[model samples]
Target: MANDPIQQFEISKILPLEALGTDISFTNSSLFMVLTVGVSAAFLIMTTSGRGLIPSRLQSISEMCYEFVADLLRSSAGSEGMKFFPLVFSLFVFILMANLFGMFPYFFTVTSHIIVTAALALLVIGLVLVYGFWKNGFGFLKLFVPSGVPAVLIPLIVLIEVMSFISRPISLSVRLFANVLAGHITLKVFAGFIPMLSKLGFVGVVGALLPLGFTVALTALEFLVAFLQAYVFAILTCMYLNDAIHPSH
Candidate 1:
């Protein structure tokens, strides 16, 4: 089981619960999600609790994260979009923490699962739809209608725009899930080689060096992908929200 890459993703029930006919068991995925939220909240709270003339390392990190998400929202959605800072910031931190936690041995990667990522993507898209309609009413439909197009081509353009809009959740969720899933699987494959080669002979032990080197490099790359995926998800959310805020454009 230790050598099985797919085994790491298996969700085991921690506390089984059922309501009527539905199974609502707490799972490994659930545990990690709760941990991610708690850790993210604690980090932000601890870092910002104390205000001083000179910032501490934790304070600096928290501030930088705040500014980073704020800047992303500002650039993508404009100053008006700062209203959604809490939502965007929370998503960014939760995903970033979940991805980083998965790097540790035996830790479950929540974002690697399509169910988790899809839920998040749907939440963002749902908000966009709800707020878009509430803010713009029927004008929200204008998002599918471009500002300038020949009358003959308007119908085809609207159809394409509608399809693209509908695909946001799938693309957003798959991008994060696929990258994390593939990276972890590749790391596990190389890691498994290290022990297998060492078991062969002295020459085999020396040959293990190549896999070890690749594993190290891949681990570093996964860390960057972790941060980048979170940023991409958050920024894309902002862009979608911008459309909701200004559908005509």
Candidate 2:
């Protein structure tokens, strides 16, 4: 058993599969990913399956999710971005589930890994770039060019804009990874102290209660962070999608 907080993230294979020349094995991370997807799918399906005139509690919750995403898209990206509701909604649910799933005991927090988040960030940036170019062609170049800059400063402005654009994926990925990693590590460290203090008799037991209390508080905060990170990711994705729609900005 590893006492190190970071080492706990390792995902070992639960059930190995060897087929068709490819090592399509299933690891803990893979299992969690499947679980997240399944949970999300079942949630949406069950909530929406009975769409009645008098909505049930589950139906209301589903409708709330739909309208929530709809409002976000409409407000952030406007009418043109409505077509991308599915993509944005899916991103929200997936990231939300990923973050929540990682909070479970004995589960690997995939979102805690930069590679997983970075890949998702890259996908968003890639979509923005591809759509921007496809929609506006050379006009998309305007994103890097400001209208009010002096001729001598045009090069510098464009360079800065380009750098910021390039850094989007890194920033997006790091934000989620750092939050989840820090929260989990904090929880683990506090948990470790509880057992260590258990041997100290009454005084130590009393002292351990403080950390236990803090850990409980922090757990609630982590849940908020999970949803907040998901919303931030989706919002920033929408903002970037806005650039695709109106590249002149």
Candidate 3:
């Protein structure tokens, strides 16, 4: 059971709650979320708390994180998008940590779950919609209709645009969820082969190296996927926000 990677995703209540339906649940996924947030927060805060005239090693790491996210936001969303720094930064760090945390011996990866990813995706999408409407009011509807479309083409164009707009959250959620889920599953299948391979003695050891090496290589690849998945999520969010800020024809 300890060797089973999927067991990491199991949910268990740490403190039973009859009130809000959840009381200190210590689910694997929940634990991972808490761990990711706690670790990420500590990493950032401790790194930057020094505020040195000349940054020390930790300070340099902190500055790099800031510059990395700042550059990402500046390039993807521009200066007007600067106000969303906290949200964007949090999203990237949280997802990155979640993906990385699962690589540990007994930690769950919340990002692997569709529900968790969907909730985050919806949160971003919801915010984009709220901000868009607040900023543009009914003019937001203009996003669905091309500025120069002939009357005959307006309906078809608006229909397609509306469908695409509605699908944003689904696409965003699935991309992260699917990637992490598949990667973890593949890791598990390879790891499971060890027991069977071990029973064969000498040849078993030799055969076992196949899965062992694959796991090692895949683990490295997973790290890259972790970063890429986070980047993809953030960039897509920025693109959606851009559309909201300036609805295209």
Candidate 2 has its poorest 10 consecutive residues by lDDT at 1-10
TM-score of 3: 0.92
Candidate lDDT scores, in order, read 0.95, 0.89, 0.84
Best by lDDT: 1
Residue range 1-249, candidate 1, lDDT tens digits: 689989889999999999999989999999999999999899899888997558899999999999999999999999989999999999999999999999998999999899989999999999999999999999999999998789999999999999999999999999999999999999999999999999999999999999999999999999999999999999999999999999996
lDDT of 2 by residue, 1-249 (tens): 455777767768788888988776798888888999998899889878877889899888888988998899889899999888899999989999999988888778879888889989999999999999999999999999978779999999999999999999999999988999999999888877888897899999999998899889988999999999999999999999999998886
Identify the leading candidate in terms of TM-score. 1
Taking all chains together, each candidate's TM-score versus the true structure is 0.97, 0.95, 0.92
Better of 1 and 2 by TM-score: 1
- Pick by TM-score: 2 or 3, better one: 2
Candidate 3's error at 46, in angstroms? 1.4
Task: Judge candidate 3 against the unseen true structure and give its global Cα lDDT, from 0 to 1.
Answer: 0.84
How does model 1 fare in lDDT? 0.95
Error of 2 at 152 (Å): 2.4
TM-score for candidate 1, residues paired by index: 0.97
Clash number for candidate 3: 0
Candidate number that wins on lDDT, 1 or 3? 1
Q: Looking at candidate 3, what is the lDDT of residue 62? A: 74
